[model samples]
Target: MKYRNLGGTGLIVSEIAFGTIPILSGDVPVLPDYYSPNEETAIAIMEHAFKLGCNLYDTAIVPEYGDAEIKLGRFAAHIGREKIIISDKSRYFIGDEMYDAVNRSCKNLDTYANIYFVHQVDENNEDITFGRYGAIDALNELKAEGKIKFTGVASHYYDVLLRGAKDKRVDILQGSGNILERGMLERIESEPLFKEKGFILNKSYAAGILPHFFRIETLLSGVLSYPISSVLVGMGTNEQVDQAMMMKTENYSRPSFSQVMSVLEKSFVPIPCDRCQRCRCKYGTEIHIIFRQYNYYFLGKDYWALRKLDLSINESAAQCKKCTDMSCMKKCPHEINIPETVQMIQRLVEIHIRKSLI
Candidate 1:
């Protein structure tokens, strides 16, 4: 396994970081799968990954990731905390809340996190997170106090991450990308501002759906082709650890967006959004995120994706119909029919919700 510097932090980490979501014992509905291995089993799986050279482990606080944080602390103690780098995060947006969250995470880990991110930052909470006494400030204070070595901003939206990149307080950025949704990654590659900060990419397998349509090496190679510090994969078993870590590193060319779409064509008509976040909604809806949920529903996250779509699909569709703005389409490089696609997804949600009731 090849090691890479995590930005300019001077910390060396494996190309593949261990994501602890799958190893958590719980019925986390948001998660794609529910494989709750016992503490002994979870430790063994992580230990296997460690032996395979995975030094960076990422987890969140309790209730968000269930007992995974505590389990990670136990594993850290078992393997000697100094031997590994821990990356922890919380969903709090306020300064006081975020500052307290980091302390709680330290207690859960039984040691300091190498990096602590303000996770899932988006437009709704972007102001509070980046504003005065926001989560970023809290992280900065924590860094000064020696609680966490680095401050990170993790978001699914490109704009949120761009702001984090521009902020001097942030040391690392975490985002999602895969072979199918490589549009954001493409944009990040073209922008020089992102090169100054470390990037850790998750959702490499599109929440474990792409693996069914494409080979593991294909997904890993495509995402790894970009300039990033690490690719986080949630491994639940020893076999999963092997599949994620043992990619053929030599002579693997990154697959083009067209090639990725071609493979998905065998399964279903995937929305060509690529999640660039170029389309802005005046109605305060996340158009790209909704489109992703539509694709995810068909890709095996049926109920979970549907539930997310149900939250704003009707309202967003209504907004799309009432508005006369066509800028969303005009700005789309793929020229996707924004209104029509939204209506189509709305119909999909209605159909699924109706069928489930029967």
Candidate 2:
């Protein structure tokens, strides 16, 4: 297994870090079978990953219903906590809630986390993040107490995260970047500060959008080409763990950015939206998120992904029909028909929700 320094944290992590999300079972009622492994199976997979030289483990509180943290804590205790690097995330917005979340995580994990992330910061909640009683202050307080070794932010917004990195506010940046989603990649290449900091790349599979055979090899190689510190994969089974190890050990040529991009463009039907967020909906809709979730639903064809889209659809569906001026369609740089796409999603969401209920 190959190891790299996670940004400037001084912690040497495996190139392929084990993400604990798949170990969870029945956490999301909408998708009970979605990556849900039994406790024994989950532990066995994680132990196998450890045998393959994976020392970095990531988990979150709310998403996993605390099951992941509890199980991981038990496993860490069994294996000796000092031997591995454990990272966890909290989704709480306020400082007090953030503090409680971290405390609960530490207690469950049986030790202090190596890195504690302020999870999912984006343009929509930038104000809450940097506010006086926000996650930043909570993380700072935790760091002072020696409850966590470092503070990080996992965000989808490149520009917002880049500002934090430039100000030296965050020690690590966990962002999504793949062949199709290249925002984070663009920032890393152009910004020296971000390149120099600790970066852990996630969503390399684009929520399982990539095909299986070339998924591990292509995605790993593509991410490695950048100055990223680690690539996080939520390996659900022993075979998946083995595949990641094999990809690292094998001497295969890594695909260049252009090559991968060309393949993606040729293989998949083009979606006009580039997620530029330039198209302003008259009803205050988040068009980019809608399209992104649509892509996930199209590729994954899973209830969980569909359910996520349903939540967004609920917010914007009513407003979409009221706007006949089509301002968003005109403003889109890619000239995508925003109203038409929203209508399609509305129909799809209804169909899927009915099926799930039945």
Candidate 3:
């Protein structure tokens, strides 16, 4: 496996780092079958990743009810301390409780971590991540005292995350970006302008939705074109891991610009459902956010993001007939063709249901 320079730091992290979330709650519908993995399988997968030259592993303090960190640390211990570089985080406010959270991560990894991430950030709590009491100061203190190698943030909100990216003190940053969530991609040309700092690209599989519109080769091809130095893929099986490894090398190169454009041109627009409360969608349709559903279907098509939304538009996935046309799309900002998109999603949902059932 090839490695890239991490930010301005000399650390070389693998292109496909591992993310350990046994389960994700809220706005998400499906969880990977972490339950099916015995301790043996989990151990094997971790070992396999390392054997394949994955030097870095990322785990959270509260990884889906505590199992992930415990298991990860145990694996690290078995694998030998010198073989891996670990990164972990506390998704809490940085002050007061931050150090204790980090200590817990160190203990769980059974070794010291190289980078300690500052978890999540958004509009309401930008100060939580950027202020003196946040990860920046805390990390600086720790680094001065010889606790960790560097610091960074993992954010979900793009705007707030972009702010984090501007901070020179922040060593690394990770957030949601996928083929469907092209919003983040638009901001990437400025990546070189990060004043020489680099970010790690997560959600590369679009949380698992990119494969919908494009063929698997095409999706993986586009992923390698991202500007960030590292991209993480959560692999449950060895086949998935091997396929992901293929994205890093020159042997499996990216699709050409026209190849990308041609694939996008055939893409369908998202369904029409104004988030406005004026026209209602029955069957408990979240009239507002399903646009993300359609966007996920087309642009990024990350299954994890789609599942994260926890949206079930219809009873059987073919239930678009549950609502009449509210014409909410007519008032949208960009003059989007809304109703047609909803119908398209309805059809897609049925297809999803059928494929899953089979």
Instruction: Give TM per candidate.
Output: 0.96, 0.81, 0.71
Candidate 1 segments exceeding 4 Å error: 351-353
Candidate 1 residue lDDT tens string, 224-305: 8898899999999889999998876865457877887787778889898898888888778788889898888778887788
Query: What digit string (tens of lDDT, one per residue) describes model 2 on residues 21-129?
Result: 7777654653223466777777788899999999999888745543888778877887788888988997776788889989988987878999998888876777787
Candidates by TM-score, descending order: 1, 2, 3
Candidate 3 C-alpha lDDT tens digits along 1-358? 7777887888888767776553222222244433335556777877887888788877777543246666777777889876787777777656556677777777766667788877776655678767878756777677666677888777765565667677877787777654444445446534555435656766656556565556655554455466666677777676666666655446445555345445656765343332222333444444445666556545654454345344565442344544456455444533554455556566665566335434
Predicted structure 2: lDDT: 0.75
Q: Clash totals for all models, in order? A: 0, 1, 22
Q: What is the lDDT of residue 35 in candidate 1?
A: 72
Question: How high is the lDDT of residue 237 in model 2?
Answer: 85
Best by TM-score: 1
